[model samples]
Target: MNERSPVRICILALPETSASVVYGMYDMFMSAGRDWGLIVEGTPGRAPIAPLVVSRHGGAFIAGNNVRITADAPLDACDDADVVCVPELLVPPGEPLAGRFDDEIACLRRCHAKGKILATACSGAILLAEAGLLDGLDATTHWAYCDFMSRQYPSIRVRAHRALVASGDGERLIMAGGGTSWLDLALYLIARLAGIETAMQTARINLVDWHDVGQQPFARLARTRQAEDAVIARCQSWIAEHYAQPSPVGAMMQMSGLPERSFKRRFQQATGMSPLAYVHTLRLEEAKQMLETDRQPIEAIANEVGYEDAGFFSRLFRRKVSLTPAQYRRRFGAMRDAIGCISETR
Candidate 1:
């Protein structure tokens, strides 16, 4: 007897949220499904053709008659799905989530209880976290919300370096960061569910780089030390090592045994940024990490990042992130809560 294949996907949609993620996910899955022989052509003797996608809401959502879609079923349809996807939603203040939060949570729990894969994209991670599935798991969301995720859900280990996070054994729960990361998540799912070939084909069709989980969205500056530029390299290393300390330019020049003009020119040419600017950038990056991972007070965070005054830290953080320390913490706190909710329910 032949073994049966088990791969069924069902994506849940929230009203009034971004639909691009859903469409993108659907396209990737459908393409992969065709490639994997999951969706076969109908025979002449078979019943009439039917639509594969079914919306949650009943009526067709027509935006100026340009786009139209009619929902086929409700959240209960998720029970038979092997994988369930939730797209990003615009969260409002003082409200859990609009458009079937409780129902979505129940559906997620049901799916997980039956060993189905649960995936979320962008702010949709909040839904999974609220469902209690992300507790004590290594997860990440959009970098902008990393701090909020950490504070709200202290049990879950949050990392800010990546665009996607998979939690639980066998990667049963996964979350993708904001923006176009939905594409990455869909490709990841395709690679796992179908095969690498299908994922590669899909990537080719979409003209997207098929990135591996190990790759980061951001590029790191390269550090190359030549024999002639030993002093400059050493000074750069010192700056990296003593970023938290207020090491003046004079100190760097003295350490390198080079004159001020030479040191300044060499450092700028090597690093592409002024010496003090580079130091400030490093400190700010460190401060960002501290803000996301640590639960320390604002003043402590400022001091740890070499800011003598909390106000200065706030100003720098704002300049870099367009958000103050308090605002950053609040955002991460919300994310943490969302994650905590998911963990508890799970």
Candidate 2:
């Protein structure tokens, strides 16, 4: 007999949940499973598929489809689910989490203990973090909640800059940033468990871009570019052009034809960082790419990134990223290699 394929999904819905977040996930899963021939019953001779969706209150939730789904089981439904998604909760200003806190916490713990993939959208991350599932884990929520989450759970390594965070081994625990990121997160799960072709078809049907898990959310990208003042935009353009050169503030001012004091003020006002600091960020980003794509020596990589001293490059890389260049290369570079291998196989 063939080995049993375990693929089940459960959504935990709360009161006043975001309709888009919940339905988007549901749509993606259904469409992708169909496209991939992973829809269980749709296959030639496979077991019937069982998809369950439960509400926190165990009743009919009018999810705007004229469709009412009865949640037969309570949080116990999470235990049997291969993937459990917590949709975006309705959070009032200055409030932590609404009531039903204790029950949600217990449900998350049970699901996590069973080694099920746990995913959350927007302020739903607050629920997971409060449940202590995100402690010491790299996670992200809506960018607006970054400061709040950091203050609420200092143990969680909050990444406000990224769209999604998946830190546990095999990416069992994932948190998506922003409200709409639920679409990407759900499609990503489908791709991982099902296949990329399924995800692509789903995206085509949904009229979405089908961004990869690594793609930063639009909100995070906006925040990154929020400091774009006239001077800053010019500096950014120059940095893009000369990213491989030494990017000292004096050099930037000279290139921009601005006085030193004026340039410093204008640049800081626009970009939230000193010229040199911004340049370092750009260089580090480039170095990340080099580390992933090239097999060059650290010294050569440093030189290509405009750092003459390999030791200096290592120090800067460690300061920017807690890991040395080689370590970063080992971790993320291997991921790039795996992606390349998959592409080749395809």
Candidate 3:
């Protein structure tokens, strides 16, 4: 709380926690306060935050990938920190959290009651949800786990589409978009607590780039759980290969050798989408890939994906991707091309 004293950051280390995230945050924050001066021409001042790794039981423990790290202190031993950061826990979605993290949950609840801003990255939101801190608040996690988290915690308003969400009074809680975007949380916490200059210096020092697109663009719609029905499997495979061809649904129905009604029922049961919608999803995914990787014109991409009407394709692309094809290209493709050019020159 004191401007002159370092902001105390307590990072909780749980079983199966991502070692990269834990060490990454610790290193980045330390570098911000300790190494910024060495890297920059004119040093301002020492970094503001003092970070410590704390566990439920303080000691050396193995993280998700068997990377062992020792805690500076146990949660019970540590004082209330300025910020309590929850790193990505590699727990499966929809698993019960009561037995595994009851103590951690209690600690978090007490911390929140005392008004410590609780932040979670990726699946670490699981801990916050388990603690019931996120109820009635907008939150997000790894896009793959968004639906699972939403279904498990119906009271929490989950926004899998956004990159980061900070809610509650004084924004005491923050949820970064899942995965590597946790760096966004790091940058934000620095700016909020340490000042913008420190945050910018940290970003520049770490080469952390802001991701413009949300998780929606990267979702693989067709990568859903497939049904056990062998007929439906074949139908799905055929559709994946021939989605650009006209009359795919009709062809699939005939291939199934079932009555139209039977084929439709089985297909829907298998993929959780209508046959026509599946074709559209396939086409849209292909279109997105081309838009991100190729220089083809929008109309050409549309036709290649089986849309004769580029206007219709544009509308569908927007509806599904939340970005027009050209917008997607500009957002993803141009950056990728620029990165490629840089790499080639290097």
Candidate 4:
């Protein structure tokens, strides 16, 4: 995108959307063309973007924070946006969206059909999925909603571990995961549409960290639910206690009092994982915790998590976590210490 013309950014404002996201997006885009050079030097630069908040109704709408905000224009009236951004939507945890926000979905479909670049933050990706825009495309949302989106819309490939994912034709679809990631989306959109120098300038002015590790570190791994199966529930509870025991799957099978064939079938149906796979996951989770918090040696941590060989555990950790145990400790341990320092000061 050239800087010759101002890029029009239309931020969709809905009743369920986060108020901070809408305002922050507008501020970031508007500051990009002007704030960077002023912060670096004394130069006043020309604004490169024209951002406007558009709503279904032209009247004032209340956001998640109970703040009332009036839109710059209605969605129907604003049909010439170069980029359309869908901010984080307020929804209850683990609630199925069902028939909610159908009108917004339709409007987004229209925007995409008009060749406008589409972007989503947090649960807003649900709107894109509902609009049939993400079908057969690789998309991501907040890690919490990843499984829900994948189960609801089976055709779309969900990358739960990515902080941001760009897919589809010409990579028109941009998605950022969970809360506060809309800021990352803003910086990226500026860089893509404006220039890297412009994005860096904006970052410097705002004191924002531009690079973020993907969603893997923040993901909730113990999210497995036993689907109303008593046998599987019992097995899971037993595994929780004896995950470090040798032959955990065998012990679970015997404790379940079900035949091997029936046990495997029921386990898969309830947990969506094989019995052995579940055991390995439990061990890995325990190892991850030890790596993050404790100062134990890697070999001792491996033994605690039921792995006799440290080399094998290290390989497995790298494969699943994209970081070695030592590396994970070095990064997250320092982060935890920094947070502790802030807490102490407070």
Candidate 5:
């Protein structure tokens, strides 16, 4: 940050916002052009990016995880900030936010209209979509919300595979994918506003790695939440415990005590998926766990998860999970072992 003055960044804090994302961005932003100097040299450099958390109505509030959060200023009073960020909002997909965050949404639009670079970590992109600022631009959010955002806001092109996206008028609107991909977002912002050298230094100091695989591999193909319909719920519970059995979907249909057409329609209505799709989801999820934790033969594992043909299973796994079964095992198994090694060292 060779700029004469600090980069002013205002983080828009909202209800149910994750405390970690908000404060983590704040810390990283404040550290940019500052922390590296402190660690390498005896003297501390002046912070390059000045960050403040501003809420719609400035004050103290509880976050989604019951942690207390305090805003630095009100949104209306934050016109001077060069960058405005929306931290991860603990919003569930498919939940309507029609009457909520009206003030915050309007403020975001005004800031972007005034040429302020707007960014969001994870689910916070929902606000940008609601504000209509991302229309005609490529955008992304948490994997869980990608489909919902696309269905709800058809104008914006939702890129579900990318972990980070930057698109809008002049590419001022940026977003990061689920969870700690915010680290990547912050580093990119630092590089954009400060310098690439500073961003690289910050990444090295924080030991942050990029999520190169994107979000598709982490996304589940089908919903697992219980359905509102009692019959569908019973069928789901049955299938959960018997997904490996042959004709699992048929067994569920029989257990549901409904005619074939009625059962399929009702199951689709209740779960947003067909019966066979739901069964496939259950089987794949179980197979993923086995791949991550065990060294069993792929054929045996496939058989155990209700797939008789290993070739068919491999193709299905690749199609649904964006990774071959063997690839998934190598990736997750190595990840698990790395975590264990890190834990042991600690």
Candidate 6:
């Protein structure tokens, strides 16, 4: 908060957690405000982040990959910290984390209740999901785990292709997708807690880059899940669930509480789509899911996704999705059936 008082960041360490992520985050956080100024201007700047590692107990232990770690404090000692971050954990996707982290999960709940900003990188999100903290909140993890996460926690809107996601009330729950996107998460946290200038300086000093293009390309999927703007992010999440409602764009504009022109501009900037286009994308995505999994009539699917006229919906589907509604269903629906059969045989 001040020059002398840095943002206290507590990193949770577990036996299954990777040491590289833990220490990589530690090094970057330690250099937040202090490195760039000294490197360029030859004057030391105030350190913006003070990182502390905490484990289940109050001592040293070996991590999953045989790396020894010493904790600065136990989980109970984290009350003084401003934010608690969970680096990647090496748990298997779809594996239940039922009894492994009772103490760690409780600590997170307590910290979140006290309004401490809670964050996770990669499969560390599983711990947050295990804590029931992500209930009814949009979230993401490594792409491979997206389906497992959705299946395990149905209340969570799993954004598989999003490299980063900020959800929950006040957007206090932050998560990053697989790999080095944790650097982006750290920079974003510094920007949120300290200042954007310091975050930029940290990036410049560390030679780290933001993953602006997101993980969809990596996951071999596509779409815009951009949400750098907090207000626009909230509106986007709102419209995701309510896309089937009448006049959804107007509803999002109202939810954003911005002037018509301002809301339109910000929405476009935040997502690469106009307000109407954004709503249409969401509706079409839902229609695709329904078509793949259900045998409902095309008219029914169209109407359910907020399109009243079946003919108009068919035209738009072809124009935007490059396939007729029936054609899209026949292709992907068969794929789904084949996948189901394959799974059954296996």
Pick the lDDT winner: 5
Off by over 4 Å in 4: 1-4, 65-70, 92-94, 222-226, 255-269, 272-277
- Please give me the total number of clashing residue pairs in predicted model 5: 0
- Screening candidate 3 with a backbone cut-off below 3 angstroms (N, C-alpha, C), the clashing residue pairs are 33-47
Q: What is the C-alpha RMSD of each candidate to the true structure, in Å?
A: 17.9, 11.0, 4.2, 2.7, 3.6, 14.8
Q: Over the stretch 268-309, how does candidate 4's per-residue lDDT look in tens digits?
A: 777657898778778887887777787999999999989999
lDDT of each: 0.67, 0.71, 0.84, 0.84, 0.87, 0.86
Per-residue C-alpha lDDT of model 6 across residues 104-175, encoded as one tens digit per residue: 999999999999999999889998999999999999998757766886888999987678999998999999
Using lDDT as the measure, name the better of candidate 1 and candidate 6: 6
Candidate 1 ranges with C-alpha deviation above 4 Å: 1-6, 33-58, 61-69, 92-100, 211-346
Distance (Å) between predicted and true CA of 205, model 3?
1.9
Cα lDDT for residue 170, candidate 5: 76
Q: Please, what is the TM-score per model? A: 0.55, 0.56, 0.79, 0.88, 0.82, 0.64
Question: By TM-score, is 1 or 3 better?
Answer: 3
Model 2 stretches with alpha carbons more than 4 Å out? 1-6, 35-50, 62-72, 211-346
Error of 5 at 147 (Å): 3.9
Per-residue C-alpha lDDT of model 1 across residues 318-338, encoded as one tens digit per residue: 765556777766766567768
**In model 1, what lDDT does residue 236 have?**
75
Instruction: Give the winner by TM-score.
Output: 4
Question: Residue 49 deviation, candidate 1, in Å?
Answer: 17
Write candidate 3's Cα lDDT for 162-268 as tens digits: 87889887898898877888899888898898888888888988899965566677766535445579999888878888999989999999999999999999887
Q: Order the numbered candidates by TM-score, best leading.
A: 4, 5, 3, 6, 2, 1
Positional deviation of 176 in candidate 4, in angstroms?
1.5
In candidate 2, clashing pairs total 1
